[model samples]
Target: MATLHHSSFCPHSRFVRLIMAEMGMEPHLVEERPWERREEFLMMNPAGTTPVLVEEGGLAVPGASIIAEYLDETRGLGLSGLRLLPESPAARVEVRRLLDWFLQKFDQEVTGYLVTEKIHKRFMTSQHGGGPPDMNAIRAARSNVRYHLKYIGYLISRRNWLAGSQLTYADLAAAAHLSCVDYLGDVPWDEDEMARNWYARVKSRPSFRSLLTDRVAGMAPADHYADLDF
Candidate 1:
């Protein structure tokens, strides 16, 4: 069985989880804090990031995008339908573009804010290298949330999924980052019905169930957090 060492609040980890779910592959899970700097964990991933995958034969795989591609290639599930990556140049470009948007743009603008404010202190209360989170930064992120939501609304309004017609890794990436924000009650679901509807579908998936169960000390998630219908 493949083992995953990850934190529930991480969007990148969640992205890989969504991919395994889309492929109908489930792996055993283990929770670990990245900051502990454990010898084994650090050896497995010198970058010291979560979402490291231990393959069946025991090779530590780092990074969500890399792990997803590994799963796709090893499992023989080419990205055509739900997997999203395809042999065709057009399909590959389409999926790649969306993946970049979510992993880079969404993570930098949206997840960075909420994770630092709500989730980071839990794992990083001791590792205050960056000093306390800038409330101003969080405030800025909160303000930027509206723009992200509107952008998503536009995408969902035009395309069925964030990338291409089918539910691709891009949707999972967006949903993963959004989930972290949602956990902090920062997401304004009421901003767009279309966006809300899209999230509902992504939230209802079984892979997302684990993420919904996450809780940070003294930081209780909002009431609508686990509610699929809400």
Candidate 2:
């Protein structure tokens, strides 16, 4: 079995975890704190990011995107009808585009700010920027998330999933980030019923069970965070 270096609240980590679960690969999960910049972790990934995959041969694959591609190449593509990536070039581009939108753009604008301010800071020490949560950043993230939710609603209104007719890496990526924000009780699910419904479908999947049960030590999830019908 492979080992996964991850963090419960890190959207990128959560994204990779979801991918593995979907691919029917259960890895040994080791939660990590990227902010600590541990020497060993740095050796594995110079950037000290989470969601690094260490295979049986000691090969460490770093970053969510790289890990996703690596997993698909090594195993996921063999899943046939269950593959998270599409086979056609145009369809694959759509999946990749939405994947980037959620993991990069939505992250920078929403999930990153919310997690850094609410979750990451709590676990950090004073010297490592640990302190009271930044209300300003938190508030900004809350406001920005509504736009992304609206975008999700717009997309889902037209298609069965984020990228197209089938579930793809894009759906998992978006859900990973939304799940983190939802844990903080920040996602305004009521504002976009279509988005909420889309999320409900993803959240109800067997691959999402582990994530729904995730706990962050001192922090509790929102009331509806684990609700399948919500």
Candidate 3:
């Protein structure tokens, strides 16, 4: 069996988890804090990032995009479940585009700021630069999320999923980031009905069940974190 090293509130880590579940790959889960920079974990991924997948054979795969592509290559796309990367080249390009959009753009503007301020800060010591959450950063992240939610609504209104008609990594990527923010009750779900409806569909998936139940050591999820109807 493979082992997945991940953080509870890391959106990228969560994205990889969702993909693994969707593909029916049951890897042993090891919750990690990348900030700690453990030597053993660093040996596996020199970059010291979470969501590293170490195969039973001792091959380690780092980063969400690499792992997702590696799984698609080794497991054979569309074999066990939905094809995360679309078959057609054009379609695949679109999927990758949206995947980057959420993982990079949205993350920098919203998820990254919020998580670092709200969750990571609590876990860090003053020696490591950890302290009280920055109210300004949190406020900016909150304002940024509303625009993202609206953008999601616009995308889903035209297509069944973010990238296209078929569910793909794009959806998983977006959902993963949104799930992290939603856990903190930062998402304005009520502001965009289309986006909320789209999320409701994604939230009900079997792959999403584990995330709903995920609880950080000292932080509680939002009241509706696990509610399918919400």
Candidate 4:
């Protein structure tokens, strides 16, 4: 069995968790608070990121993308239409490009702000005693979210998923970030019916059930978050 070092609410960590569930592999879950800067955690991945995977031979894999590939390669979890990468050069490039979009774009526009405000406190404590989140930054993030939804809406209206016709890593990665936003009702579900319809299918997956159960301190998930049909 593989061991994964991660926290419960991190979007990146959640990415790895979703991949594990989708691939049907059970990994030992070890929580790591990124701010703690522990030597042991540092040793696993000097980059200091969560979602580190330690293999049987003790090769530590960092980043959700790498870990997902490792699992598919080692565990033979490759489902015909579900393998994230494509064999064709063009399609494979597109898949990787979309993956980067979600990891970087969505991270900057959505997860970065929300995590720092609502989710980070529970996992990342301030180096100083305790500090309140920056309301101004939160406001900017909230505003940025609207554009992202419009973009996703356009994608859903045109393509079957966030990528092209396939449900690649792009979908899972986007879903990972959106799950956090959705938990807080930050997603404007009524913004676009196509996007809402797309989300309805994504959120109904067995891989999504655990995320629906996630809770944040002092904030209840949006009432409709766990409702599969809603």
* CA lDDT, every model vs. true structure: 0.81, 0.93, 0.91, 0.80
Q: Encode model 2's per-residue lDDT on 1-230: one tens digit a residue.
A: 89999999999999999999998889999989998999999999998989899999999999999998888888976899978988899998999999899989999999989999898998999999999988888888999999999999999999999999999999999999999999989999999999999999999999999999989888889999999987
TM-score for candidate 4, residues paired by index: 0.92
The number of the candidate with the highest TM-score is: 2
On lDDT, the candidate that comes out on top is: 2
> How many clashing pairs does model 2 include?
0
Per residue, candidate 3 scores C-alpha lDDT tens digits across 68-142 of: 899889874556457888788999899998889998999999999999999888899887769999999999999
Candidate 3: worst 10 consecutive residues by lDDT? 74-83
Q: Which stretch of 10 consecutive residues in model 2 shows the poorest summed lDDT?
A: 68-77
Q: Tens-digit lDDT track for model 4 on 46-107?
A: 88888898876899999888886676676634477677665677887877787788888889
Residues 8-53 of candidate 1: C-alpha lDDT, one tens digit per residue: 8888988888777777778898887776777899999999988899
lDDT of 1: 0.81
Instruction: Show pairs that collide, candidate 2.
Output: none
Give the winner by TM-score: 2 or 3.
2
Model 2, which residues run further than 4 Å from truth? none
